[model samples]
Target: MELVSKRAFLQMVSPLIQFKRFRGKINIQRPRLPHFEKAKYLAFTKPWFINPKKDKSQVELCKGFGEKLFEKDKENPFQEIIAQELRRWLTTSRLVVFYHHNPMNAEDEFKAYVMFKKQKMHFKKYGKRTLEMAVGGTPYETILDLYVSHNMTVFSPEPEIKKMLNITKKFPQLVLLAGILEGKLVSKNDLVKYSMIPSLQMAQAGLVQTINSVGSQLVSNLNSHQNTLVSHLSERAKQLEEDK
Candidate 1:
């Protein structure tokens, strides 16, 4: 076979978004994929995902999720098979994904636009996670963009990966994950460092804003360590004011 079918090719390779290696505050900014919002608007779809009782077809449509009823079937049955077989190739995989399977082929741009709009609604209702972010602009809609201003490529494609390799080519701090991911010996810190973005994104977003625009807040999210840092800084400011 051609390594992977078009379907298998897309499905087998799980795109890893945040791998945890990017710890510490070295002043990395929020990720801004070029025209990400527009791409999301394009390939996004609101799949009418249903938690079927006996319907394998319905379950498989869910992308390996939902309460399954049939032994021969599973959540998102088609993808389940694809995921299971690809387990060998996707050994270091975190999230198995399919980004280009369009059951509803568009006849024209107008209809395609309509489908895209619906997909966005579905994505919003379902709520995206780090996994979805890892998969680029969601499946069958757009491929992952390898361009990241921050030299992180846990979720980027081959081209971007090359760039990442080139930049970290000489840095010992940046360990080679490609070998370890392929069952070669390597340090755990290397993996952890790559997975660092999700936490940082969560923290920085917390500092700058909330899920619901201004006024509302969610302070409890900060871990004990981060909380102590903020608290200490506040206390120090208060002491300085008193001394003055």
Candidate 2:
């Protein structure tokens, strides 16, 4: 048996130990070859369909991911119902006033409601969508522009233009914009002028008086012609008798 020095033996054994450690430390496996079926399936599968119109970019870009997430439902049933009711009001109400108003606390709003109700008027607040749905494609659509920004509405069955103006005066926060009287859209200035005009009964009475005066004058003129003819005949008869 050949004798080896302790240091030389340790050096030789150390290399083998290091080689075993390296082998254990490093997992030398071949690069995985994907299963043929899986590879084919992956290669043939459709690429994800990204929705360009989607508002967010995330898992939704994957095909069939949350298909219903972006789907739009129909208009709210309540909105439709309210819109129908509004259309009825606009059509049936004799006075529909659109007023621009400042933001009011709940208490003030309640007070306003009570005040309006006292005069047999309705106070309503509607969203633009509701207004659009109600008046869209109708003749009243021309007044749609007046429905913007913090708007409140007053609906009265009577064409109480003057009364409405007076009521609005009590609420300093409310400024009238326009009104629909008897299905006609009247501007603010026109509304003031309309309020100043006489009532329907007064107007009818004046018209009747003028017509009567014209008729009386016509009768007087007609009688004047007949009276002149009679007078001329009487004169001719008198002259003939005198000549005889």
Candidate 3:
């Protein structure tokens, strides 16, 4: 074999080396966290059971500390923190909990997260205004309805909770767990039932239709009586004319 100089060999392989380095960097990039647009309800995964504390550093780290720390703390620190956060958020807005076994892959999760962020921004900007424009409710009622609907729109899956009761695999790994409504913790079954119930708008529309139906029937009955009287008078007029 012909002898090759180190400089010549390195120069020949420079492009290949650069390509490998570029690939390494791409591989090392941290996966993006899931973003929830209008995430009226806060959700987390099984990881919450491991470290409930938002600030992981706060857990006192000591030499030889392991499972003992968890054993000593009867309650899960992570779960407590999550619960507290739920309470705070629920006070101002609506909240629900969801659990999933298989999380989305990094790429898909990141895309979903991006979409969520965009939706959240959009809701924040126009949600209130849209609620105000809604018909058949007082200002206070509309405002309250707006908050409820806003939270519903954010958390519930399509084709909306009103339309469908079952939690489908629409979002794949994400499963509906529990919900907090009107400052109460609702079980999964309750949540489902609640979702099945007609929304304020829907219920109102139904009521309006019922009232209109009753009014129409009343008007029809009155018209029938008038028609009968007209027929009777016409017969009487014909009989009198014939006698004359």
lDDT of 1 by residue, 69-146 (tens): 333532465554444433332343332111221233234323433433333211011112222333334331222231
Candidate 2 structure quality by residue, lDDT tens digits, 184-229: 8888999899899999899999999999999999999999999999
TM-score of model number 3 = 0.43
Model 1 spans > 4 angstroms off: 1-74, 91-164, 167-179, 185-244
* TM-scores, one per candidate: 0.16, 0.55, 0.43
Task: Write one digit per residue (lDDT tens) for candidate 3, span 47-123.
Answer: 34555444556344442376665555355566555444433333454443334334457676555445544433111
Worst 10 residues of 3 by lDDT: 120-129
Candidate 2 lDDT (Cα, whole model)?
Answer: 0.87
108 Cα displacement, candidate 2 (Å) = 2.4
TM-score-superior candidate, 2 or 3:
2
- Give candidate 1's TM-score: 0.16
Count of clashing residue pairs in every prediction: 23, 0, 3
Higher-lDDT candidate among 1 and 2? 2
Q: Rank the candidates by TM-score, best first.
A: 2, 3, 1
Model 2 earns a TM-score of 0.55
Q: What is the lDDT of residue 166 in candidate 1?
A: 41
Q: What is the lDDT of residue 6 in candidate 1?
A: 58
Q: What C-alpha lDDT do the candidate models reach, one value each?
A: 0.39, 0.87, 0.48
Of the candidates shown, which would achieve the greatest lDDT relative to the real structure? 2
